[model samples]
Target chain A: MAADLAHLSPLLIVCCVGLGILLLDVFADPKQPKTFIGYVAVVGLLVALAATGWLFATGGVLLTQPYFAVALTLDPFALFGFALILVVAILTTLASVHYLPSQRCEWGEYYSLVVFASLGMMVMVAAADLITMFVGLEIMSVAIYVLAGFKRQSPFAIEAAMKYFFLGAFATGFLLYGLAFVYGATGSTNLNVVAEHFAKNDPGLYGIVIVIMMIVAFGFKIAAVPFHMWTPDVYEGSPSPIAGLMAGGVKTAAFLALARVFLTAFGGADFENLAISWREVFYWLAILTMTVGNILAVVQQNVKRMLAYSSISHAGYILIGIVASRSVDGGAVAGSGLFFYLLAYALSSVGAFAVVSMLGKDGEEDITYGNLAGFAYRHGFAALCMVIFMASLAGIPPTAGFLGKYLVFTDALAATHMNLLPLVLVAVVNSMIGVYYYLKVIVFMYMREPRREFETIRSVPMGIAFGLAALVVVVCGSFPDTTIRWSAKAATGNPSADSAISAASVIDVPAPVATTAK
Target chain B: MEQVIFWILAIGTVASSVAVIVPPMGRNPVHGALSLVVAFFFLAGLYVMLVAHLVAVLQVLIYAGAIVVLFLFVIMLLNIQSEDLGHPRPTISKLIGVIAVGFVSIVLIGFILKDKGMAEPPVGLPSDSTFGTVKTVGNLLYTSYIVPFELTSILLLVAVIGAVIMAKRRL
Candidate 1:
């Protein structure tokens, strides 16, 4: 019992911060700014992140407890996700500190709501039961829907909220349907039980429907094509920092949940026959999402919308890593490249959006090229920070994003199970196309003259936010070894990944089938 | 006796459910909602036959007691006349939707034919007597599912707080 509670400390800590902020808000002066609440949120997340790292270091989730739990998994895989989500939430709070007051929506509830959303995300990544995952996902989405429209006076913000709520509810419906179908097939909602059932018995047609429904629901969250119609509008309409949170924190949480469910319940040695079809589905999905995302992004003049599409394309790159990491063909593949790329991509997108949010003056977003012109001349350091983020996003060297792309593509090439070569080639071309638009921002910032007079918010906190993100981007890119090894260790949440990682390590590998049953 | 009662309740459920969408009951929203309540009670009775007492009670309390009343309230608040409703039209999209549904049905039928074991739906098999008891369900909530149950309260808080934040006139 004590060990179980120890596993729960990160979530408990964040939930306390959320409620504590709400309680403290009662005493704060309404006439005063609420950035203090934001500071508290940051400090709380820091403590939680530190606790997560400490847990991972000291033999994970409660050294006394067994490797698995019934409702939540506090394994290294989940701990890695927790660290990334906490980082993004902390950055989001820092970015919103100045933006909220500038827009005159600096209510204490905003800070509490963001903290609760992170709490929700922590639950999602740590879910061991399908039901737990669904509930956690709902908590995260509901909080974000509120944050998306935090600017209540703006019609665009309200529209963003309603649109996201409707579509998110529909996606959730798909997930629920999938859940019911899986239960009907296996007579269990537990991930380990579902995996054992699928391993022993052929899932047949019901499995196909379940897989497709899960894909559609998760696809919407990660902004994959055919389910990505909502991304551009919602991103454009949302408060800029909240939009960054959507692109960063929410997307990371969803992807982690998706990987956990699919890799655990659906991937293994015994279920290879079932895995092939979904892998093929993802291969085509990866191609379409990247090609379509890149081509459409090139024509968008609004920086926010363009970044939304670029995030979609980046999702495709990460999907390639998932495809490669999924199969177990007794190959030397050490990791999925998922954790490292996710960390890199989350930081870059949040950093980029933080810069773009600065361009919003007087609560109105003017992020077009015309508005961006002469940004370098006005603010040299901010422009430089923006350039580092953009270059990283475009997968240039000396940044985390480049190494992130390198690891994922190499994983795809190294996989012996399926021919992922074509997918990697398409990603190569797509990233090339991606570079053109990523540079367009740079061109406008340094070269073009300002078409009309415009002023940007140069708040100290926003600078700190992007500056910290940029620093991480550069450092992670240069010193990629530790992150690589840590993420590879993190990839061992599923039995197949356990086998894969163990195959490369000097230690004797455990029997994959023995653990597959539990 | 149980079989006879099951048959009666099943017939009542189907009949009232059909009444909700056709003829005189359908013409009036109030009447349709009333029929829906009747259908809900019949369903609850069927659930009771399966030994799912908690589900039967929830079917009555949530569907008949709460949801049906909410429906009646909405109908009354809107005061929409039946004459205000448009006649059903068969549009191109509707035609395509029908075709798509038919195609899926055909595919499912083929799958059922190929897989003989899955062709028949499982009917009222015996379940544990205590499986759906209120006490057992409550135990499950506080024991095995304590984490998810607590988390859902946080979810409700987000929804409630969000509704207030969005609905309130000012921050």
Candidate 2:
């Protein structure tokens, strides 16, 4: 019992904090701006982040526990994912302090919703069972649905929320049905049980059904191509800070959950079934997602809409790491490649969206290139930070995103079982195409004269968010060793821990085998 | 006799389900609601035959009782009549949907007929009298399934807060 509680501490802290913010909201006057609530949320998230770090430092002795239910795990992989999510949550809360009031939709529930959404994400990535993952996914997605429409007075925000809600519910149905099929095949919802079942038996046509359903579910969650119809419209319509959360924090959690599911429960090659393997499916998804994302992004006139397409392209890049990791010897190297890219993409994109959040006031926003003409002359500091963000997103040198691409492409090259060479070449072409659009914004900011007078709302907390994100981008780019080593540990993880979970859960299976031995 | 009863319940369930959405009776939302209740009852009868007694009870209690009531309330609040629904039109997507559904149903029937695993009891299942009992369900909820059960409470809380925040007249 004590061990279980110890393992569950981080989730508990975050859940309590979400409730605490709701309780805190009651006493504050509605007429006043809820900046203090934002502070509480930040402090709470920082504490949760520290707890995850502490659990990691102690090596989380979680494997030895007799946690028979096996609903959630606090393995190094989960902790690493949790840490990234918490960082995004903290940065988002800080930026939202002034953004809500400036947009004329200040409300305390926004902070609580953000906290709840983070809690949901943490629950989702840590789950060891399909049911628990679904529950966590709901918690994360519901809060985000509401957050997307926080600007209640604006019709666009409302439309964003409604579109996201209906589509999200549909995708969730796919996930639940997929989980039910897995349960039917194995008679258990536990991931370990599914892994064991697939090891000895061919799931055949049923397996193909399961894999495709999961792809559709996860594809929608991460906004991959063809499933990405809603991304541009939703992002363009939502409050910018919330859009940042959707791009940065939500994508990180969904991608990590996708990784955990594919790598753990469905790891065996026998899962190839008779039709086609999931690896080939994702390979095609990766190519199409990036190519279409880059092409569509080039034509967008709105900054938020452009970033939405950019986010879709980033998902394609990250998918490369996943495909590479499936190869035999690609274990830790490709795994780190996937994890490192998430870190880089999350930081740079959130930072970029934070810059956009400052430009709006009174529920009115227009971030056309014409609107941003002469931005460098007007808001020098913000424009400089924007340049760093744009450069990193374009995968230019001296930024985390460049190294991120380098690791992923090289990792794909190193793996032997599949020919990932052609995939890498296509990704290279996409990356070069990406550079053209990313630089267009930079040129507009620097060279073009100011088209109209504009002022960005400045707050101490948002400034800190910008500086902090910028610092991480520059530092991670220059000295990439620490993050690379850390993320690699998370990717491959310790083998003993995996065996321990099997040993604990397979207690009943040995009895059956003993009977067969007789 | 048992096989005859199973066929009656199965046909009743499907017929009522069709009536709930198809034309003539389906044009009126009120008729659709009542037809849904009949379909739920037939489904519950099917569940009982399968020995899923607890699920049978929930199928009636939750779907037939509470959710249907909520649906009626919403319909009443809207005060919508059949005239307000406008004329139903055949569309390209609707045609594709029906064809897709028919194709999937045929494929599922084929798989079910060929499945060798259906011949015997599942190796992992407990096929005793205690299975699917209320006490057994409660025990699982309190023990093995506790995490999901508790997390559901927070999901509900978030939904309640969201509904209020979204619907309230002023901030």
For each candidate, report its DockQ versus the true two-chain complex: 0.38, 0.40
Q: What TM-score fits each model? A: 0.88, 0.93
- How far out, in Å, is residue A191 in model 1? 1.2
lDDT of 1 by residue, A468-501 (tens): 9999998999998888877876776332323222
For residues A1-518, could you state the per-residue lDDT of candidate 2 as single tens digits? 77667667778888899999899899888777799999999999999998888887765435344333367767767888889898898888888899888888888899989988988888888877778888889999889898988888899999999999999999998898788778777666666667666666777655666787899999999998889989988998888888888999999999988887786677677775446688788899999999999999999899999999999998999999888886232133236888888888998888888888888876787888788888889878778878888888889988999999999999889877578999999999999999988898999999999977786778788877877887898788889999898788777664333553463364333321111100
Each prediction's RMSD to truth: 5.5, 3.4
i-RMS, every candidate?
A: 8.8, 6.7
Judged by TM-score, which candidate is best? 2
Candidate 2 residue runs with Cα over 4 Å from true position: A63-69, A327-334, A495-518, B19-23, B26-32, B81-109, B119-128
Model 1 Cα RMSD, 1 decimal: 5.5
How many clashes (backbone N, Cα, C below 3 Å) per candidate?
0, 0
